[model samples]
Target: MPATDVVSWLATAYLSGMNDELLGDIINDVQHQGDTSEAMYAVAPHLLALSQKSSGKMALLMLIHAGLISASSQSQIAVPCPADLATEFQATNNLGRSMVLAQLAHNHEFDDFKYLIAALAGFSGHGRFGRLIEGFDLYQDQFHHALLDTPIDDER
Candidate 1:
């Protein structure tokens, strides 16, 4: 991975820990999605790629949603949490396969990896839900913000 991508991942991890209190609402929303495999799946890369093309509010909203989902599912630490995992989608479609990609994108601790992989498994079993999330265009500014927040790494 490029130093920049590593930096981006680091920033998200840092801010999430620091902003934990402020992000309760968003966290819950993401957890809700994680609770259901039918909801968010393993569509990280595609969502990340799609986010780049997003134009405005839709992009921001989706991006935030996507990030939360990534963290929620990927946060292997929360594996003990009960979730309502749905069936996986068939890989017959291109998008469905992409959602599976999200599952493979997590760079979290063991606990996070467990949660994410489980969520991805559930979503993949759902037929096409994972694919649908993959097709969404969420504008994620993590890379930009991560790069900009380089000065604050010491705070972590």
Candidate 2:
């Protein structure tokens, strides 16, 4: 992707309303068609664009958790969260917050982290039925981090 295209994508993605249907399509593509070499790369720019905001981050994380890409692959293609996001989140609450941040920061393993993603997706941008959008931002990253620390086998 060219720098100009990236800039354009970022603006458009950030400004647009959350599109669950679009996200679902992208997720399906990554989950089903990800084996193809070109598919992931083709979908990466959109995923990268969505990663800029909390709601989009939820979608991006869903892709990661669903085995869309390896950690190294994601690092190569997707945008990294600002370094300060980690530090800032970690400092807020030790055990809970650190675990969430760690999970997201190290989202290479494929596991059943979908519930967390779904929860965020459900409440992202707006609460149930699009009612409460204000406090959603407060728990955004913590929600992002919630499944970050899970062990792939400890499905307890």
Best by lDDT: 1
Assess each prediction's global lDDT (C-alpha) against the native: 0.37, 0.36
- Residue 125 in candidate 1 has what lDDT? 49
Summarize candidate 2's per-residue lDDT along 1-156 as a digit string, tens digits. Answer: 223433444355567833565555554544343232233433444453354344445644533322233221232343443354434322322222233344556453333244233323322311132212111221322322322453233234
Worst 10 residues of 1 by lDDT: 138-147
Best prediction by TM-score = 2
Q: How accurate locally is residue 125 in candidate 2, as Cα lDDT from 0 to 100?
A: 18
CA lDDT, candidate 1, residue 54: 47
Task: For model 1, state the Cα shift of residue 65 in Å.
Answer: 1.5
Candidate 1 stretches with Cα past 4 Å from truth are 1-41, 77-156
